[model samples]
Target: MAASARIFSSANFNSHVKNVRFQLPCRNRQRLHLRSRQRVSKLSLGSPNQRFLSLTSFANFSPAQFSVSGGCLDRIFFGTKENSCNWNFAPTRISDGPHGGLFDDEKGPEVTVVVLGWLGSKPKHLRRYVEMYNSKGIHAVTFVASVTDVLWFDLGKKLEERIENLAQELAEWLSNSSNGRDRFLMFHTFSNTGWLAYGSILVNLRDRKDLMEKIKGCVVDSGGDPNLDPKVWAAGFTTALLKKNSSAIYPSPDKSTGPQSGNMENGLKTEPKETFSIEPWMLSTFEKLFSYLLNLPFAKEKLLRIVSCLSTDQPHCPQLYLYSSGDKVIPFQAIESFMEQQRRAGKEVWCFNFGPSPHVDHYRTFPDVYTSKLDSFLKKCLSSVASPMPS
Candidate 1:
């Protein structure tokens, strides 16, 4: 028989080892593509829709299971809701970090990883993140849930409903556990979809003071552009804006326009009310570069009330970013814009830019580099995160 053609993926090229496998995509079940209605924003949600997911929700490595090859699978045990590993074709995120074994000490350093990925990304990706963390002795794990296509669907009611599900799941996961490495960190990918969901996570954590306290830092990768990103729907934006957005002020929409003639800085928000406010797609671009959006976001005046934030509310945490020069889906300057804003706000930013590849494919490229950087980032968060531990 023909040796099943040795097919290699983007990940196989960067690293010598191939542990994770992205299965042949099924029907566009969880849509990443979106269509718009004439008056898109006005639709209403009929009845509450339900997509029930439990620990065993992912059965055959289908949309929600991560298949780890080599010895990586042996190092950790995945306790799913069912008796065995089910493939959701996606990945799963569960808890099992550096604060490993027994929690003899009530407090030391604890880390919670909030995993986010592209819209169509399956559960396997989530599991891979957990597995990588486990390998590092990070004692990190995640609660799993599926996300609705807010960017594409723009179904506010649907988005809200899905957000509640994720929030409830997260709250339940952290409700009784008083483990050490309680500090929280977000592991994200994609652009608008993840951030839209993140907005809800913050809203959900608002009432839970303890969970709020555990949030240490974030590692947002390849996302965060709402209005300024020239990519996404505008795939040719690089050239389109190449004629305009001069990287001077606001990046002129056309080259003829002399470098936007006004104050242009970094550290802005994506609020709907700000004059010349940013849109979500642009925010995604900002997430990929400069670790601060290359340029600032919004204006200084609007940041006072934290009014112009993308979130329906604002989440205050020392946030960081990850970007790459090669990612086509998300531009690199977007990350710079993020850091620029963070620095302006007097917050610190820790960035991890792993080489380059298509959109959010860092792991497939330099898995070791990506893992190493995360290890260091979490290590630094140790002493800093445990201070004034939440009682």
Candidate 2:
């Protein structure tokens, strides 16, 4: 037998191992790389395995890149093409205090405000609420669902899936961080759109006792309307959509809808009857279409069931219902009935009627009263939690 060439030099060993690692599958490659790195550190040019490692090729090895943590996957899945997945969930700092900055180790976060914003909710508007929570030494996370998400899709299934994913993500986030577990959690929901998201989250957390227990309370603003009148909802949807994408969707607004105009404070506008018109023919057409879809045998019933679950499920925490008699979107009668049902069920429910505020305009209409009510409700919820925070 002829003598074979021996290629066991230090240089050869390093190069070969790199090549072999690359040739292996992603998962296996990681394990092998770790093992090989360890073995190389204790280089033994004489050992069989170590010698074999030296000969293996590493020509194709590329370092595995990790996905950026804290980047929102929801945005990528839901946002517009131009800004998709570019969204980040960085908590806006509202205060610096002794309790534990935004997040703490021993006592957990002081509070976590999860705001489920209504359709057409602008980022700046949502930020104001974040600032509010932060001022109170609490952390705020805002999740805004797209209007199209509610209007176009089969909301029952798609919306539930989206919300369930959000719930799972939230649960994981809380579990992963030391500042999460003992934190007092509350949801501030806006309008029926917000309730859809909130209710879906509750449904997902129903069986998750651990996560459910963390919820201290919830605040519902201008929401939980039981009326499933397609025409009413469709009109609201059209107005919101038009308001949001007016220039793009209705370029010549003056000719089309009399130059759409309303309160622009937070995109939560009180529609002026005399100002805008949706082309009576088109309005009637859409109304009829929506009516048919909403009237599907079990559509409205299923939605009511979900809302019922949201009211009765887990933790049984106190809830603050903020609505107005003058709000055309969600009828005052509906709010009264819902609150009455909760009270009859022995739940800690509080109702604040903003006499004439338009839909979602409760805060703008009664700023001082709104803030006071929110402050009181949050304090009550936090005080009730068994976990004591540092004074």
Candidate 3:
């Protein structure tokens, strides 16, 4: 993980750090204030392959103490609409890469790798993946949707506005800046939240040619099912059952559905339910919400249509999906079906299975194995973009 030279400084331990803040303060009922600031840079992608593997080995480690040497991009980011998300961009030049040192020149691929996930997403959590990619000279954008943050809140017009507002802000950001959209070449994501936000943004980008051109490929991590797997249900359910956290990612009908659409009954196909403390009432609750939402006009026509950005039937751009076999959050079958569907539709899909990791646990679960695969994916994306294309 620490293949690079080791040097620590007092100010950021040799790393440039930046904290971007965007608050739409209502000075007046009819007005809002928006501000964007850039700091030096933050932590690097720590143990390149081991960060997202999901193990107890990293429990005591601290990335903040590690010094990072780099710069922040002149860019804007969209946080989870719920006002609970954080977006961190760490730019650094690999001192020993193809360009001799760092990739801040036009000769390099104008690459910006954005990580999409939950609002609580921190670079420290994905230090390895981020570090590795940056070491190879690609920019990293880490963001999350605070779906879980607002799950416990009561649904209403305000919630809808909050959700759409986040999406719109991202869209507007891409649409406004110079080379804002075209500058980004590839994306690396972890978990279902990335897709939820990206899928919606793709729909909006259709009208913005500049923004559309920037997104060439996408790598979706743990993007299987939210309301399907039980371990995930248990994790989310624990929040609902104990902390009274809503656990609802997208809008759903059933209060007890608790995300994942209510499928604790079928994890990995062989796991035992004897230990399953789930109740029949939970299933009924999920069906109620799933049935209602699936039937709603907005959901059926608008939501479903917008949500298809992650669908296999979409344009055949390069897409890599890394899912774990042991992921307690999603049934292996669900992701398998998604990959198979995409392959049958003539799209490129890279698939790898992490041996029995926790639900949505990418780092500790399959750190080195997955990151290596991702390294290959990044190289592929870089060549596709950096190399000359024929007419």
> Against the true structure, what is every candidate's RMSD?
18.5, 18.9, 17.2
Which portions of model 2 show Cα errors greater than 4 Å?
Answer: 1-108, 155-157, 179-181, 244-274, 279-283, 297-302, 386-391
Better of 1 and 3 by TM-score: 3
Scored by lDDT, the top model is: 2
Quantify all predictions' global Cα lDDT against the true fold.
Answer: 0.41, 0.55, 0.45
Candidate 2 lDDT by residue in tens digits, 1-391: 1122232234434332222220111110001111123111221223222211111222332123212121222222233322100123334343454222333233445557678877666556576677666655566766665544564344345445456556766676556665444555688898887876787777777787877888888898988775676655665565454443222122222222211124223433333435333334324444654565565556566666667776676367888999876665567688788788788888899778766556676676566678767867765787754333333
Candidate 1, poorest ten consecutive residues by summed lDDT:
31-40
Q: Model 3 over residues 1-391: C-alpha lDDT tens digits?
A: 3322111223432122122111211111111112342122232333333222111112243334332221111001112223232343435444664222234444454566666654345445566666666665566655543332223112223323434554455555455656433355466666655655566556655666666666767887767452333344334333232121222221112212121312232222233324322323333333333343344454356545645656733434678877655443346677788788778878787877654444445454345455556666655655555642211
Q: What is candidate 3's CA lDDT for residue 185?
A: 45
Candidate 3: Cα lDDT at 202? 66
Model 2 lDDT, residue 149, Cα: 52
Off by over 4 Å in 1: 1-110, 136-148, 151-153, 178-190, 207-209, 228-316, 384-391
Ranking by TM-score: 2, 3, 1
- Please report how far candidate 2 places residue 133 from its true position, in Å: 0.9
Q: Candidate 1 has what TM-score?
A: 0.49
Better of 2 and 3 by TM-score: 2
lDDT of 1 at 23: 21
